[model samples]
Target: MYVAVKGGEKAIDSAHDWMAEERRGDPDVAELSVPQIREQLSLAVNRVMAEGSLYDPDLAALAIKQARGDMIEAIFLIRAYRTTLPRFGASLPVETTEMACDRRISATFKDVPGGQVLGPTFDYTHRLLDFALEAEGLEAPEREAGEAAHPRMPRVTEFLNQEGLIQTEPRPDVDTAPRDLTREPLELPAGRPLRLQALSRGDEGFVLSMAYSTQRGYAKNHPFVGELRIGTVPVEVEIPELGFAVEVGEVVLTECETVNQFTGSKLEPAQFTRGYGLVFGQSERKAISMALVDRALRWKELGEDDKGAPAQDEEFVLYHCDNIQATGFLEHIKLPHYVDFQSELELVRRLRRETEGRVQQEAAE
Candidate 1:
């Protein structure tokens, strides 16, 4: 058993004070504002929101500032703060089909109903570091805004569904509320909804690693990006008095849908299966990684042969996915374990003494 050391209150307080001063840096330097972080460090804010399981940009930005740009730390702050917030009524699910897409692309098809809109992507940009950015107040060059090509672009999966080339997704009851792991404890052998929620809020690095493993032939389910889209979708809530759903607000989301290969079986026909990923904000990498991992987890459900892969192991992935939990357990080792160490030390010494006594007795004999 680990016991905390006493009489460190003053030292701890002093350390905290020093940390605060360090976080602020030089007095002459301009302080970073929450708004600036929210707008400028949008990706960091997005990641914090995704991992923290909170959607507020301002709060996430504030956490980022407080954590001194440490993403995992920021996520921890946001998650801690989120627990104190009062619960509002659950909002109706946003319709991704009706999304006002900013960036939409498909690797499976060259051309679709709406053309591939490469909106605000670094995909084609050179990796060279721009020295101009090192200088302050440099304005980014802007191009003329184009008119919207399509109001509601058709999903790539729909095209496959039309031709019966892919497995059809069974729509769940719209009114039925999905189980929230935040409110209730996570139970083993979780349903897709629960698993998805966990994965969506999971550590990006962990999910990415699991996804990468599948790609590297650990659990090779040949996957192709059916479509990846980043856009704002309207969030609606059913008004009790009005008895109708009204649009409350909108949230930016990155959605990735993967098409994976499945062999034909005696009972089931050979068709491309779908793996879905939806995360808050413009996180293509996280979203894509999530999709791949989601597909890998569904191997048992999909009736595929289990290859004993880590990604396929639900307990292993789910238990280790949360960085906060993982970090907390790992960081706990720094705490004083004096009693435990002392016990082990005594046992070792006793064993050595016993061995020495036995050797002396044998010599005497």
Candidate 2:
């Protein structure tokens, strides 16, 4: 009795055409260029790159444009495109110590090796809209000419490390292979590396909410920002034939180190634990949130009581963190469900008839 609607291909093509037209609104006005989006709307591009797990600024910009500035949709686009690329050699772990830091700060220490360089942050900015920017003749802020180069900044965690106050990360072993989430299905009891990978690419808003829950006494693991640094690090790939690592490219990264308090267990002495967050670009809030969530997830390993918070649940957090998966499932509700709806309708009707018959029999008795 049900007739399937045809011309789906034509409808889809027409929809795409309409979308394209909407994307390029007002032909008379100059079109927004990809380069302009890449530079001017850098933060949005950074988020897309971070969540998309791709580093190309131009491609991220393109994705952003295609998605009509919807960052999650842009990330989905980038992720889809990333799957088509052929796999080359994997890059060696980037050396953050050698990072030419643009912005560095620490909540734990007053004065670190490199003075706190509050570079290009909106933290102190007044929320008031700049109406001047709407019209022409906007002047750029004057820069101090020939400013001194920033001092080589050491990590704030290093100070804690010297006194053995914080837990040390395991030394990198060449033989140890990291579990790639893309290649393998995520299993329970995930290691630090796997969890970090998931957090790095997880939805910003979702991660932020989870992190916020912890602050509101859901699973309060007292956290302090040991170091928050944003900089560019060299990416290197090991050449098998050449037998050495070579610089492939450089990528801007935002790294956060959260030092958390841990009461001494029976076996080990009380030492500060660490939660780390590293993302593709200058996303400080996301990076900080990620650090908090990362530390929360480590509760099981640290032998602390799990308060059964959503953030503390590894399975819950990891499973629902991906926007692509969440969006697809949510959007699928629009698909044809006539058979499903008919079954439900029939069951309800049968239930109502049976209830009426029972009521009549009871009245007669």
Candidate 3:
């Protein structure tokens, strides 16, 4: 005999209480401060900000701590918080050309106008673990006197244009504002720039794996990272009161552009195809992967035939993304569904009995 399921409200309330208690952990143990998490678990914070599209590191850190260091959960927390924030106004598009860079490098040219600066990276580091980190003691590096950074950061693509190695990417009118995805539903067949925004806030592992498959010859996308830059860019919002743009705050970003080779067609000559990436904070991998996928999605725009590949499908990519949406739907399956299941059982039993009777009559004949 099946019992009618009930107490869903009570169950939900108890579950929420339990979650709160779990997040608190042992009261006797030291509680984690947001600042501590922000400083200590920087990488996790960065991942959340990159995927969540929220630049607040403290919130990201709190999410990570509450999630018990689960990166995706932390991302979800940030995304939830992101949704609650009221939109004040749109900021003027950040000028990467005016970015105060900490790290900038290009692969397309031996030397570039920007002058490659490998400011901070683990690329050349040995794989062996540094045992010094095991000890609690550490010394800060000394600051040198009479040291000054470059007055201006230059675009690496400038050098390529000088030699005519690549076509200069067209810059649209800065006045033409972009539609906010959070405010409106995302329509299909978006431009590369819009697609990048969606994918940047997309599932990190999902996007990365898709890009990896393309690299493994699942699709015909060969990418060379033309430039990878990590830096702080000013966010300027035009305030009517101020009557000019003002810097509200600055956010760290990792920007990458991948150069994909293209063949000539009737309309255009062979030019270096482009894929772009931009993400909050130091997320080189995410940024680079995003660029590759961006290019793969642009196959049709560039006059390349659709090879029926996963990357070529815009709906498949955008609709399946967003960890917040994915998690909510997946977790909802655990909720009680007695009404739906009862209907299914009745339909199935009637169908089975009818089929059996029909088979017996046929056998008699």
| Best model per lDDT | 1
Q: What's the candidate order when arranged by decreasing lDDT?
A: 1, 2, 3
Task: Record all residue pairs in model 1 with backbone atoms less than 3 Å apart, i.e. clashing.
Answer: none
List the global CA lDDT of all models: 0.92, 0.90, 0.82
- Which residue pairs collide, candidate 2? none
The sequence of per-residue lDDT tens digits that candidate 3 reaches over residues 49-81 is 888778899889988988988888888788778
lDDT tens digits by residue: candidate 2, 109-160: 8887878988889999998998887886767788686444655788899899
For residue 306, what is the lDDT in candidate 3? 87
Quality of model 1 by C-alpha lDDT:
0.92
| Lowest summed lDDT window (length 10), candidate 2 | 1-10
Regions more than 4 Å wrong, model 2: 1-5, 137-139, 146-150
Clashing pairs in 3: none
